[model samples]
Target: MTQKQDGDPKSLSAEEAKAEFLALQERLRAADIAYHQEDAPVISDAEYDADKRRYAALVAAFPELEKDATQLNSVGAPAASGFGKVSHAVPMLSLGNAFEDEDVADFARSIRKYLGLSVQDPLAFTAEPKIDGLSLSLRYEDGVLVQAATRGDGSVGENVTENARTIADIPEQIAGAPRILEVRGEVYMSHDAFAALNQRQQERGGKVFANPRNAAAGSLRQLDAEITRSRPLQFFAYSWGELSEPLADAQIEAINRLRSLGFSTNPLTRLCSSLEEMIDHYRSIEAQRATLGYDIDGVVYKVNDLSLQGRLGFRSTTPRWAIAHKFPAELAWTRLEAIDIQVGRTGALSPVARLAPVTVGGVVVSNATLHNEDYIAGRDSKGAEIRGGKDIRVGDWVQIYRAGDVIPKVADVDLSKRPESAEPYSFPHVCPECQSPAIREEGDAVRRCSGGLICPAQAIEKLKHFVSRGAFDIEGLGNKQVEQFYADEWIREPGDIFTLRERFGSGLQQLKNREGWGEKSAANLFDAIDEKRTVPFAKFIFALGIRHVGEVAGKDLALHYGEWSALTSALDAARAAALAHRAADEAEDAERIAAEAEGRRARISETRAAAIKACGVPNEAQAAWDDLVGTDGVGPILALSLSDALANPEERAAIDRLADHLNIVPPDAPAAESPVSGKTVVFTGTLEQMTRAEAKARAEALGAKVSGSVSKKTDILVAGPGAGSKATKAAELGIKVLDEAGWLELIG
Candidate 1:
């Protein structure tokens, strides 16, 4: 058997592993959302990959965590906020990964099965090098380039038409093209250009990028087209998005057509009609990878025939006909030198490890992101030290690894050779940069600075989140614009975004006269701002950018409270209940302390009603807390977060001011005619006709609330065969119980 690494997940009990798994999941979710939606990546790619592996290891130890959640569920954010956001006619998507030859074979077999063909049946394919650069889409209407966009979250992208025009490989106009054509491609910088540019930048005392891909992306997204023009960037088209008519019957033909229309296409793209041929092409591409002059991470294989690709269809996030076969990662050993904290655009204080330089997978690395203080300590979610209590520390030998990413990842700590002088690294209690108190809320993996607007790092991030696509989603106000406005002091907070027109509408500081702003663009931005004056309740709630309150939680809160007035009322009650709960805890603590001093016994246990009466907490407030906690998809943690946010005077006032800027529309009312509308449902035991998941979905679609447990509020209990205590409890409460058939009949 192969020996396992030092960070043995087996050290933890199943419960501890699960808890850590969930906490890691949440932390990654925030980082991913920032990357995909906010145009801000809090963690490096290496750290993201490492955490994903860790998440998978925990699930492997306990498969139940898979049902709990996926490590990173989706590539596209629900809404993407970036510069001049344009919705893609056809979404740019990620491809399923393939590392082993068996995975590739399985991919071919699955495609055949879906197409009702035998495994031996001839299925033509196209293999192309997967460019390690930013994805770009160039739109042409009537043979002229109209718009260019970068793949932001697949659903929407940032408009970069003027910047794209600076690239020599991108054609301004293509003769004899489709009436409406969208050419999808990669924008990259050659190794020579990257080296030369970095040298020139270093000489000029300007910013220098880490890699060619980073340089390419930075150059392309520049607000000033002159800067982009000065950068040597190239475009290579290998796919098409929206089209007025099909370019060709086959994928290869379409690629050739694009090449003929003056767009650069990958010369290495080849047609491989069989599985063996596809593998051969992959090998051929891998052999010449170093000499290619540009970086390519893997080879992508897709069905050659356009018709077959259409028939193969797409999953929610990826295409069934296409897969990216990646290269293997390399591993090496290194030493941990020091631990440092880096604050992200948000207030998240992420711990980073300074490592003794080591080469892994042909890349040299000095630092690796530790993710959070817990990761640095090798602690579980409950603060229990795992990994056999041998945490990562300075002067310890560590193992680092990487695939094709720029940064290397810390894989395992070598406590066997740890220095005797090494002590437990104490995570900072305050923000290192801002000197603000760093608060690690219960169940949160990372600690955050509580400085809010006073913290410069967080002030802009909050504004960015406020206007993010999932939030207010104001078009034309992306990262660069937000940063510029923040630096110029044109906008200081979320409310200032709404007052742009009022401040600069027709004055001497008219937006139209600004360096890059034309009359049309300025008016468009103001119009976009005005258009979002009335936002949906869920979006408005999400715009507040409260901690632990993501898009999903916002919707839950919106659905539960329905209206802002109702939500405020609930918050008030929940806050009162929280105060009462705190008082009761103090009383219990005082009783214990006094009893110890006097050497007398003190009564601690009390009935719920009795405690509420003793603490002078209103029964209505307690009931409100209970109701908020019981809301579908919401629990105590989320409820407490909402309550705490409203309790803070500064946050409350900011939220109120933002609310005043927009009309907060309540959630859509459920259908009043459905038999189970507005009723709470509980499902128990083995369902026959439908899975438990299906039943819950159907109930929800019909306006019925499906709860996990039965309570006094439960109106109906759908008990299947082998029903248990839930059914018994339902009967005791005089609640209506139904079989699977009865449930179906009632809904019908």
Candidate 2:
């Protein structure tokens, strides 16, 4: 019995099987603890599922022995808490999963029958990826994320406060002032990061993660935050459990609200007005699963209308309003033309596929991601020797398919499809954008340019990024416009944008004299530029387009660095220090130059540290800087962007010119509004002051723009529960993420 309990296959007697059943319960419980509370898991889903199924069968056969089988009735353990715990306004529940298309169709049929509607009836369903990850219940008070919890059982679970904070995707607060709200969703690991992490673990002689789902579960469960911090995690919100006020009249609106609040809701999500569209979406997603960068076993279909969903009610673990449409796990073949490396704002080198133009679904896809180097050189299923053109080279036909939309990756290469003359791809030794030498950072597979802001490609991309909706938001200047300007010698640097009015004034005047460009239209365009001139410090920082800087980061930078003049001085000093540290390393004075190097690195990477250092004297601190740094959530990335921008002479001049007219003034410090002021307000997340619908209505009533995401035109991002990506991007762009309290303080 003891041997059976310990997973010894040899001990397969009936009595031993009974004992093993009890042990299985304990194992499952422990696994659940690791998964739900800590945001990590110890075993693969297949292994866990096998054990669970085996235990279930044993308990069913031996009801007498089932008395000790705690799996059936035991409530889950509570998570270790770092935040104040609060009961959810509504209980967040899990969905029943399906493993086949037929099962999904059956579910759809059942839903129709339950509602007494014929299959031909105009029933609408929204199909989205069923994300496999940890579930979280976010609670908002006055539009702030006051508490977040793990979904333990159907009813209760452990508190994972500190663990949640490590997830940058989760927002700490939302905008708008609703009384209460609760949102629920899954948090998981990205495939690339998961593979990288597992590789590191294997190299270190540690256990390897079987998949991204397991990796996510494992990362979240670590008792030490430092461990969790090392893992790359992402989140996607699909539903809400409860709210103080009805968020939206429709389920689609609710999801939209969640997205606006800063959560990474699936952008592919669509609202279905008819069953055909719903089924089409399900089939379409099933077909395109291989292109999505995550693993998803199935698509979760839900009713589009909140009222209709409410009318349907729910079962024990699953909602009656929703069903999972499972896609078959299969791979498909496609040709890979060439591999191109793209450097992100964070300097992560991603391999992109230049494929033979193929139509998958409605879109023509000419590119696919190659993932990492190891994938390119790997073999296939048939054991027929997977070969690239030269060696995982261009002109190789590849196979790909998704278990789900969570991670889309290359599965195999067809040697026969390789072109006879295809050449082996040689990765550039230098940054493609800049002439600077590229170096792989410590323990990282991706090589990055050491050129910093000197690279033309990097600079152009940064400028475009800065002008993006979440950043400086120069309306007429979009990606194409910026690219054209950069290519045509219209703008050499970010600061050159400020001088555009002087350079293009004649162009504008001439245009007004032409057929299409009226004086009023040209004046409006100029006015738009003028509007962006006196931008806020955070926006200004984001507009500089530094590597890794986003809206949230931009805000953090602005608050820390304060005034432009002071920040520039600090960056110059920091740049000098970074140079010194590099020199010290080359000279082998690693220990002797430790302090000097330390000071330099801190300025480069440490946002708060550098700001504090920069703000050495009382007189050196500007009121805005002091207040900015003192703000609750400001941090490092923001500080760096601010410092860099301030250091640029061009930026300084741009600021001076803009300040001459469009001086950035803080929003009327949380004050009462005029009855009829045509004001603008942007919502950042879930609102606790009012329901999302109510908030939008109120904004419209007050003559404000109710937008989907943060843009230059957006007045606010009325955020509520589970705000994630939007918030981060907003910060990167220097847009504000106001809490309900702040919003109410201002509006009231």
- For model 1, name the residue pairs that clash: none
Clashes of each: 0, 67
Best candidate, TM-score: 1
lDDT per residue as tens, model 1, 1-748: 0011226777754435644675666666666675555434554454555566577677687754553343334464644333587889999987777767888999998888667778668889899998978889999999999999988768778898999999999989889999999999999988889889999999999997767777888888888999999999999998989999999999999999999999899999999978899899999999998899888888999999898787666764678889988766667899899988876545788777888887664455787766667667776555655555567888889887665544555667787798999998899999887899999754356688988778867878778777766677788887778988888898888888888898885642567777888888888899999999998998887778775566666777798789998988887977777766555545655665567689987665553335657767677888888788766556544566678778888878887887888898998876686899999999999887755655776687677878889999999999989999999999999999999999999999
Q: Pairing residues by index, what is the TM-score of model 2?
A: 0.41
Off by over 4 Å in 2: 1-330, 341-350, 359-363, 371-391, 402-408, 416-423, 433-436, 450-454, 506-522, 557-662, 666-748
Q: Estimate TM-scores for all models.
A: 0.67, 0.41
Query: Which portions of model 1 miss their true places by more than 4 Å?
Result: 1-18, 33-83, 102-124, 272-280, 330-335, 342-349, 355-366, 378-390, 395-399, 403-407, 412-421, 428-539, 551-650, 661-748
Q: Report the C-alpha lDDT of model 2 over 491-551, residue by residue, as the tens digit.
A: 7666677666677775676536645457877666667677776778767655555543434
| Superposition TM-score, candidate 1 onto the true structure | 0.67
